[model samples]
Target: MPEVPQPVNDNTIKVRQLSHYQFSWVAGEPGQNGTYTLQLVLDQGAWEEVLTLTADDADALQDLLVNTSVVHYDVERRTLLFGVTPAGE
Candidate 1:
């Protein structure tokens, strides 16, 4: 038998830096809900975490990422620049 996925209850992990991410969708059987899996690689590949989200939640996240402005890193300043302005400029 395949292993069942356990629910995450009162557990949290903080990711400071994200190196990579991947999204996966699994179709369910008749009268069942599909699954969305999000894999996150953090801290320059030091750690990896996987999250399972519902269809609504996944769509919300996708919309947020799609609508958000682009982010850039400043090589000279060594900081992340969000949008057109680098905070307090």
Candidate 2:
């Protein structure tokens, strides 16, 4: 499923996976100081983000989700970058 942009107020945000390939990314609110999280996913199926930034840094996010077929996702953001292809034939 496509990753939805989660919220980060104090420290971190939890990425909810809607499918097998739910790639996620995140950054601080626009002009909201500066704090960023490093996104990583493993084969073991684990997603986590850490607060390694302050409210003074600008951080944008980008993710690549590989789905089994056509995964559906809904996010507050209107636009996003997705790299996908048809599932196995």
Candidate 3:
């Protein structure tokens, strides 16, 4: 058996929401802006804007953020460990 690669400090990660159960965007950078439009694709599907950052710098909609549908993720890790599960039981 193997252990999951847990986030050493998930708190550092920041996410901007767009709507409830709709679209939520996470970014490695800080703050929201017109250039920060989150291009997200849930389950590796089509890409869509989770949060519309335009005009003045504003945060993403809290209701629009979705974590379960993390279609894509660019994680930054210092030391990561990989593993594999048994093919057959």
- Model 3 over residues 1-89: C-alpha lDDT tens digits? 88756664444433322122233334545564324444444223422234455423233232223323222232333211122234795
TM-score of each: 0.53, 0.21, 0.21
Alpha carbon lDDT of each predicted model: 0.59, 0.35, 0.34
lDDT of 2 by residue, 1-89 (tens): 97855764323422233333222235548876444443333223443323243323222332233323332222333222243355883
Writing each residue's lDDT as its tens digit, candidate 1 over 1-89 gives 97745663223333234456678999999999889987756556655667688988678766754555553333334333334555889
- The residue pairs in collision within model 1 are none
lDDT, candidate 2, at 63: 20
Q: lDDT value for candidate 3?
A: 0.34
Off by over 4 Å in 2: 1-32, 45-81, 87-89
lDDT measured at residue 46 in model 2 versus the true structure, 0 to 100: 42
Listed per candidate, the RMSD to the true structure in angstroms reads: 14.2, 14.8, 13.0
lDDT of 2: 0.35
**Candidate whose lDDT is highest:** 1
Which candidate, 1 or 3, would have the higher lDDT against the true structure?
1
Badly placed stretches (over 4 Å) of model 3 are 1-34, 46-52, 55-58, 66-89
